[model samples]
Target: MTKIANVRCQLVDLEPETARSDASQSFVKQETVLVTVETVDGMSGTGYSYTIGTGGTAVVAMLRDHLVDGLLGADARNVEQIWQRMVTGTRATTVGAITSLAMAAIDVALWDLRGQRADEPVWRLAGGAHDRLPLYDTEGGWIHLTCEELVRNALAAKAAGVRGVKVKVGKPSLTEDAERLAAVRDAVGPAFEIMVDANQCFTGAEAARRAHSYESLGIAWFEEPLPADDLAGHVRLAAATTVPIAVGESLYSSLRFAEYVAAGAAGIVQVDAARVGGITPWLKVAHTAESFNVPVAPHFLMELHASLACAVPNGMYVEHIPQLGAISRGGHVIEEGWIRPPESPGIGIDWDLDAIDNLRVA
Candidate 1:
């Protein structure tokens, strides 16, 4: 048995590729918590989770002060067992952001180890349901961008072969939001996909109103139109609109996703691997969404999500928001608007160790 010999955690602060803002918050930086788990035989794998700008230290502390000791001598291959142990040990913090993020770092690292030992990519290990996933640009559609800017970016993405671009909705008025989306729609034409994201900015009534307004535009989906915790509101909004309600990025557990899917609140599920705990639970959420015949277009972390999206049969699109350039070499190869998962073992991220060292803050 390859017993876990060492576990290390570090914090790296990375700036966003561009100044980004939506209805909810501004992304000032990515406070990433990186974890490395090494076995007694000298094999190692890396995993990470992030916050937009805060709580990175807490995530690190959770790993160092509570999680790492439990992993030091456990069977590294028994990922599910270790994951459950961590959840049980951190019972007080289970199903919350910091604990989930901490577990995610370790859980993904274990999956990485599994991939390396099996000599297969994480995608194949997870499911290998698809070889590639279509790409959509979210970086180009911040709420702060002007209508012209949104149009230009959508055109650029389309020209680059991207299938769609997400336009952030939640201007001061509904008409303003409509105008902005209309401009992008006019520029991209009807054939290209346009997804509108409210970023959890609207009330159920407001979300329903906007959904109705945007439905004529032929958007791919209305993303996060209401707060994630408001299941009843989402159900109401989803029922009231022809536009699909896409949620799950802010949900912290598979059970929460199951609730949304079961309630018919989520027409499209957008699970984030890091936020939902790790690859283990992430797969659970994906398969759960699949059982309901719902499509999953994951949230951020494109580098990690690329492989995960390909791993699932129901994955719809991978949102494009590159944020790893400062700590990694190369990036996802976007070929004709689709991203192919890296064929290498583990999670498929090509981490730049030197870059990570330079940015390490804890």
Candidate 2:
């Protein structure tokens, strides 16, 4: 048997290329909790999860203090069994963010090992629904950028063959949001897609007003207009608007996704693998969204989400945020306007071990 031999976890902080923000909060940095699992025979794989700017040490603590011990000597191939064990063992925190993020690191490492053992890339190992996915730029759309900056970024992305760009909304006034969207729409023109995200900073009534105003500009969707937990409010907003209501980045479990889908509260499902626990539940959420005919445009962690977007049929677009550059070599290859997953065995990221060591804090 390929038995598990050891598990190791560490924390690394990476600065963003530029200041990032949305309606709800500012982007300070990314605190990443990385995990590596090695089998008795010496084969190994690595996986990771992240916090926007905090909680990485806690995730590492959860692994080192509460989770990693159970993984020792466990069957490396029994991914589902081991995932359940971790979930049940942390029953009190099972469906919460820190626990989910902690489990995600370990769970993803197991999937990586599974892929390496089978000599397949994770996208194919998971589902192989498609080989490539359309790319959309979100890095240029921070709420703090001026209208001219937004136009410049969108134009640059278009010139580079990117299919679309997401613009952050939720300024003090709906008029300000309208002006920003209009400037980008007028610049990018009608053919290039434009998505607007409020970052969950509006009430149901305010979101409806903005949705009506943005409809004229031809936005692809209105993302996170209301808070993630407001199921009833989202349902009301969905019914009131012609534009699709995109949600799920804040959600921590597949069950939460099911609740939203069954209630007709979500028009687009934005599952983040790290937030949902791991690739195991990430796939579950995607498939669940598919069952309801809801499409997926996962939130961030572009390096990881690229493979995941290709793994499922319902995956609509992969948001381009590019947060892995500081600790990794190479990147997603964008051909024409679409991004392709790495064909390498296992999860496929080329980690720069020296850089990781340099940044390691825990």
Candidate 3:
């Protein structure tokens, strides 16, 4: 048995090349909490989770003062056992972000260690359902961009062989959102898919109103229109429109997603691995969606999410938002529109330790 010998955490502040803005908030920077786990067998694995800007220090503290201690001396290959131990040990914070993110970092590292020991990539280890997944671009579709900007970016993604572009909605008027989407649709033509994201900026009533207008433009899905907690609201909104309702990023547990799925509220499950208590629950949620015959197009951390996405049969698209480009030594291969999973064992993030070390805050 490979015994875990050590666990470490670091806080790094990463600024986006361009600020990202959606209807509800602006991401001026990201604070990533990077975690590393080493086993007695001379093998180590790295994993990470992040906050938009704040609360990273709390995640760092949680890892150092709390989660890390529990992990030391455990069997590195017993991922599920370790995961449950971490979750139950932190029962007080179980339903919140800090506990979930902390668990995610450690749980992912455990999985990474498992993959490395077996000399297999995480996708195959997790369950290889597909070799590649189609890409969707969200970089150029932020709410701050103008119609002309939207068209230019959407066409660029299409030219790059991306299957679709997700434009941020929640403009002052439904007409305004429709006009911008229309501009993108007209620019890309009917061949390229157009999705819309509101980032939880709408009420159930407002979401339903906008969903109708979006449907007229042939949107692929209406994402996070209502807040993540409003399962009944989402169900009402879903019944009111033909466009699929996508959620799960803000949700912190697998049971929450099961509730959403069981209610027939979420049509596309965008389970963010970090937010859902790491790969263990992420897998549970993905399979949960599969049982319901719903497609999963998980949230960010594209590098790692690509592997997870390709692992499950119902996995659909991996959001092509490259947040780790500045700190990572390498990136994923996007050939024609689909992303090919990294052949390297474990999660594919190749940290330039020098760069990451320079930005380390804890």
State the lDDT of candidate 3 residue by residue for 33-107, as single tens digits: 888999988899988898987789898888888888888899998899998898888988888998899889888
Give residue 150's lDDT in candidate 2 (0 to 100). Answer: 100
Residue 20 in candidate 2, Cα distance off native in Å:
0.5
Residues 1-362 of candidate 1 have per-residue lDDT tens digits of 59999998999999888989999999988999999999999999999999999999999999999999999889999999999999899989988999999999999999999999999999989999999999999999999998889999999999999999998998879999999998998888999999998899988888888999998999889999988899999999888888898998999999999999999999999999899999999999999999999999999989999999899999999999997899887646789899988888998788999999999999
Cα error of candidate 1 at position 57, Å: 0.5
What is the C-alpha lDDT profile of model 2 across 54-132, one tens digit per residue? 8888888889899999999999999999998998899998789999999999989999999999999999999999999
Better structure of 1 and 3 per lDDT = 1
Which regions of candidate 1 fall more than 4 Å away from where they truly are? none
Cα-lDDT of candidate 2: 0.92
lDDT of each: 0.92, 0.92, 0.90
TM-scores for the candidates = 0.99, 0.99, 0.98
Candidate 1 weakest lDDT stretch, 10 residues:
325-334
